[model samples]
Target: MGISKKTIRLYASAKAVITQYLYLPGSHRLNNVIKRIDKLGNSEVESGIEKVMRAFAGRHRNIEQTFLNHFSRIADQNKSSLEYFSLQKKILLGAFFTKEYSIEAAALFNPSIVPHPDQQGLKADEQRFIMSLRATGEGHISSIVFQTGIIDNMANITLDNSTGYFTPLKKRLDTSYNKLFISKRAATIPEFNRSILDNLPESFSAAEASHILNSIKPTEPSIIDSVMVFEKIMDNNYELESSSHVPLNEKVIFPISNAESMGMEDARFVKFHDGEQYCYYGTYTAYNGKHIQTHLIETTNFDVFKIRALYGAAVADKGMALFPEKVNGKYAMISRQGGEKINIMFSENLYFWKDFQILMEPRYPWEFLQVGNCGSPIKTTKGWLLLTHGVGAMRTYVISAILLDLHDPTRIVGRLDKPLIEADENEREGYVPNVVYTCGFMLHGNHLIIPYAVSDSATAFATIGLDEILRDMKL
Candidate 1:
């Protein structure tokens, strides 16, 4: 049996544009460029400052303040005393070193839906949702952006208009690491010395770890490897904050950690409950041009986030999604460690996972190449309804559904033999052709609300009856 696609009309939005600031790199070449601007005549400098502000002031919030911040960082080494007006001029000159980056200029796709934290203003049968999307910009660098919307009982979707201003978190919050976990991760590197971790407290800060690394003298040939590992560990664990004044849609979670300098791709967000309060957690892939790592993001109110690298053998690949709640009193996750088969993993700690059991494989011809979970499994009365993506001939990607035993999610109960959603004629054109992918989906009443990407270029929504999907599945 196959899932019947609904006939609802779909639309894409062009108004959800987020702007990011691209700062100039600190280098000898750039140093000379700034020096030449500093030597310009007063009249020239004033004229340049006015021109720059007139063009960019309307595009950003507090543009002058941002320029001043950048100037202070770049000119801190200057020993020359200057007047307030001169400093302002210098700040304006530094503004030339910055450019506004439209984060979603290239593509906006791979969306995940979660229930909004505050849902007080909605009508009956109307539920508020917070959708996280992968906003790809120049160079295909993806950052996490958001859209707030509502889904009515009839399965109609409406996305809120974007704030037009994008603000990356300016400051990182200091985070502490578990001494045991750090030591264990260090042992994985062949060049690392376990003794370096000795005598440290159970929990330590980044500075404390760096200080310990500095005390060691490296005479081994793998010294570079050891240093790289240390830096990677420090870079992967950090915190970020956005201003409260910024709208949720305006705030962007850009790549801050060195491990994810390339991009943060496909965030699968789930509203997790720990028997008391609900917290949102996302498992996303972090790419650094050459290598990929899995990272975990946690936030209670979506304003502040704590992103850290996932550790252990099972956290090695992309498409790792956590169960919305604990199973059998342990944290559960769905992962694809071998790149083809879906595996279920349980962990005592959220950041670390070492054990896994094979749950599903490519059983149908439509998924002969590979299969992965679309998002966290949605729990239903019948079972755990899991939306999955499958790759077939010509590298086409399609969405399908399966049911897993609620108590033991590893046991498959029912599955759809035919594709549920595939790339249509109009949707087959984009950055990457013939692909329909989604990091997550949400269930509203009797409808399955799917916000998916078309050929990796733009995002659109679809809806299907949950009962119809279940009835068509084969056990």
Candidate 2:
């Protein structure tokens, strides 16, 4: 297969990056590194370039960073480095480069030679990568490009409309491309084990569905700290589970906290465990009640705890809010002013109540004069566990956890000497950082399921062992 001028440019662009590392004088260590790039396998300068570029950063930082700056650049004012070209360049940068700074280092030089024959960025075949995304819904943004040459020039593009790249001339069929990268397309999709896409509204357009498909993926714009997370839902409610443990009462009713917004959105009961069902607590911003949680479904006999609501409720005159979780027939809680603590209270029976009316109080260590920030709680084998997120003067909230006695809830079984988990650059730099909040958790066999809202736009999940966390909770 003969390479077109455009492909040749992309190929050369990739090759130039390698020569600068091997042939260009630098720390002989950097030069020595390129030989390994050469020795890895047989190559026509072109294919060799791809192999070297892919492996360059994997082995070391110095060379990869040199090319990355261009990859990360939103605009190509410099127009002089291997990173300077199409989305494919950035794709390679993300796959090969390690530390973000490594890619940043590559930005130093403007790449002159095109990787292809005509020195263009992406070849047409590469452009097809974006086209495969099928839209199932709406409100999406995508990036696309078009080959609007003198109509006579048979030049190709790395990205395109039919193949899912960005273009300047708007065709009636092409979706709007901001190139600010607000749009999306599916990069990887497993062969269907049988995909069931329900709740598809008829009002949405094909372009809109494609845009949404892009959003629910591990895309470059959505990558956090260079790590991409593919969530089941790009943006939706937190996971709700009916307690796995069967409750004493078979008819436990969850009061609809946010009934108006949820009921209209197709809220219904989906059984998780044989007898476990999740209550979809929803909210309505159109009305003055956004914090309202409504019971969308009910499970006959189960054990589930509403974590955030445990703390959001204002105590009579405590001057601080407390959050509580009922675990193993015991209560685990944390307060805004108090650290990790719990107090099992005795309560009166309701029409079909299942929990003990245990009084829960703030269980903080005596070390801090001020109360600790409030956090979420979950049950663990070690004890009744809690993840507290307290606020500092900057209004910054951090995520942390500690454990309590499984039997007698008041006992301060263990406290995290320090916060076990906190915000990273991703959570800290977006709409809001220093804040990691979990509405609830799913105790799946051994792993603790934690789903958190990111900077408030999207949602993600993290898994940690129940026992490993207990190991860290030192008194």
Candidate 3:
């Protein structure tokens, strides 16, 4: 009944391509490369610079500025040696150290949608929205990328065209850290030296923390864990800002910390509301090749982001979706700590979590393997409408829905008797086949708009009546 009553439309123009590239600096053999570049005579250097600019400048925005920025990454001693050279020669040297990396060459999927912060110029039924997706490039490294679009009254999605040039964000290390907070978060580490942390001032700078951590001369193997813990925590926290001239869609949040050295996967972004103030919060899994942890991200606008690691037992698994507002004066999160069932937790502190209650389990054949929330729950007059995904036999993934009481979300109200949506014949083939997934979705007017991944390779959209879904859910 559910499958026959609804029709899903796929946008043919909404797919990621391999042409977009980020201007990344290559640091391998830097000293040798600089020496070789210095050996070039004036005429050779000038001619080479001109040729490089002519062929490559058109492909990037502010190519010369990017080259200069890459040049600044070289050691001060190397910069002093190059001071005698002309500006053109220096720029050419920077170009030699830079390479282009396509941010989405492999796949772009798992998108979550939130209303755009600036919604000034829209018609009565037109809502502008921001969508974040996981862009996988070379090395299978995944990063968060954005797309802006508008949903009309008819429930059609029109994605903004790319500016043709994608640029990476400029990362700034957080200048300060709270010593007590750091110690508390790191307390779970077996060899963490709380004594050293106790001696530090209440507040400290990153340099101070590093100095203290480095000064420890380990007498045993366990002490090394203290240093490693400090370093990883320091690396996990940082701020990212986009170039003023870069469009939202062109700015990419690549991995900058050791905690997510491998990738940042499946960011579930929600427009969080507190009192009269509002900001965006996202929970994503940070993978450093060997281990995984949940990280919390905060931003008022899409241009700037503050990312930090989430601590405590409830965050041990991936797919932690924050509710739009606090539940009974505490922040609420839906998580899958055990990887088999959907669980819910509340926290007084946003960065830490300790307790959770089982919210749902695998009840049917389609979800006999596991179940998880597809994104943040959407508040409705009836209840909190949550989109979910279930894994059945052959690890097949299908998107479904459930309802929770508004005041006390821990109480289940209604659930879907069958899958809301699953992979179609055509949608079931890509990077990871037989899977349909989404990090988040949004409710517009009477329609629920779902932007889902097709086999983990590309993204597509689906729209169904909110009333139809509520009616189908079993109470």
Candidate 4:
């Protein structure tokens, strides 16, 4: 009735040494600060710049250049011209507006594992893996960070040391939006007018949409509310990318859009093959401090990412996981739209889905509360193995497993009546008590590598024999 428990290894959490500097608005009266900088003497400006360079040169790359970039952004806000200020003075002024942020100050958990694309110089039994984690910083905001390592022949885990530097992704301003999708969403708003969207192209940028909205002269006060809604929708659908020089582990996918202003939670990453090429795709929940929405993140090299909003009636709730490949010539996904039962959905298009069917429900006492998929299903020789989470008494969360027919995934073949892994004494004492969760897992050799969160605070790893778990399944 119970599976054997194995050893679990704890990883380092929230290293203060790794930090990213952000450009912040210094004071309420920014114009006065700029004016004061313009009056500084030549020697004073040179001395200030020298001091800042000496203090922060070791902490970041090209400190002076970063300061200049910040200064240029701040100068754009000033009413007066920055032509009078010297280069040194501008750089010095930029230092005052820059602030250091610790990316993982709060916690690091909810890990997802995928095989590294570049797998060279590895032993016969060793496979390289890229691990993505949820790094919570100040203000309880969550960002996606990564780590790289290998699983040896003996099933021992070895993680590479991080460079102690984190780079946030830059928003790609040229990202376009679909006019049809926008029109459909706009119809739900009471004050939105269909005529205002007439002349727009099939695809357009945020700026284009804003210009169209501004040109309309509505006779009612509710038009202001409609304008606000239009702006928010544009903000939710944007793109972000990181520099090529930044390593995979050093890149941080922080929330840039208003829809995810609060946090980007529990990304379920799967390395998918679409017949011609392979790409990495992740489904995550975006929280805007008030409401939650579903988002899809795409990346091939892990250096750059394209994030977009997922639209559909079935994508209304959290815990959405996509299969690694299409089933019956259509893309398939697992979701819990009702928040209690597991549902399967298929779509010809990746972004929009409208069809769904009930897959499973709470039958066992331990899962009477609710159930959801843990990550994307792992295809095996037996069937499509799906890892799931079930909530029970005291609001405790536990991981379980189920098997589905290979060709017809909608047909359930077998299930595990008992929990595979549960929180132990040491794991049940963090931010949320009695919770052990994971976004995904990987299979290496004969072992299943599970990187799981401990009470929603930190991350750890555990390995289970693949054969043992398969033999223990109840058909």
Give all candidate RMSDs, comma-separated.
Answer: 3.0, 24.7, 3.4, 2.9
Q: Would you list the rank order by TM-score, best first? A: 3, 1, 4, 2
Highest lDDT: give the candidate number.
3
Kindly report which residue stretches of model 2 are placed more than 4 angstroms away from their true locations once superposed. Answer: 1-346, 350-377
What is the descending lDDT order? 3, 4, 1, 2
- Model 2 TM-score, all chains together: 0.32
- lDDT digits (tens) for residues 265-375 of candidate 1: 999999999989889999999998999999989998888888878887777889999999998888999899889988899988887788899988999898999999999
Instruction: Enumerate residue pairs that collide in model 4.
Output: none
Tens-digit lDDT track of model 4 for 115-224:
88888999989999998898887888888888899989877889888786776778887778876877776764557756555657778888887887788787776676
Candidate 1 collision pairs? none
Regions more than 4 Å wrong, model 4: 1-28, 176-194, 201-204, 219-230
What would the per-residue lDDT of candidate 3 be over residues 92-193, giving only the tens digit for each residue? 877886776766777888999999998898888999999999988878888888899998998877888877666777676556678766877787566787
lDDT (Cα, tens digit) per residue for candidate 2, span 117-178: 12245333221111011010111211111111111112222222222111111112322232
The weakest ten consecutive residues by lDDT in model 4 span 15-24
TM-scores for candidates 1 onward, in order = 0.90, 0.32, 0.91, 0.90
Off by over 4 Å in 1: 1-28, 76-85, 171-173, 176-181, 184-191, 198-228
TM-score (C-alpha, index-matched) for candidate 1: 0.90
- Model 4 — TM-score against the truth? 0.90
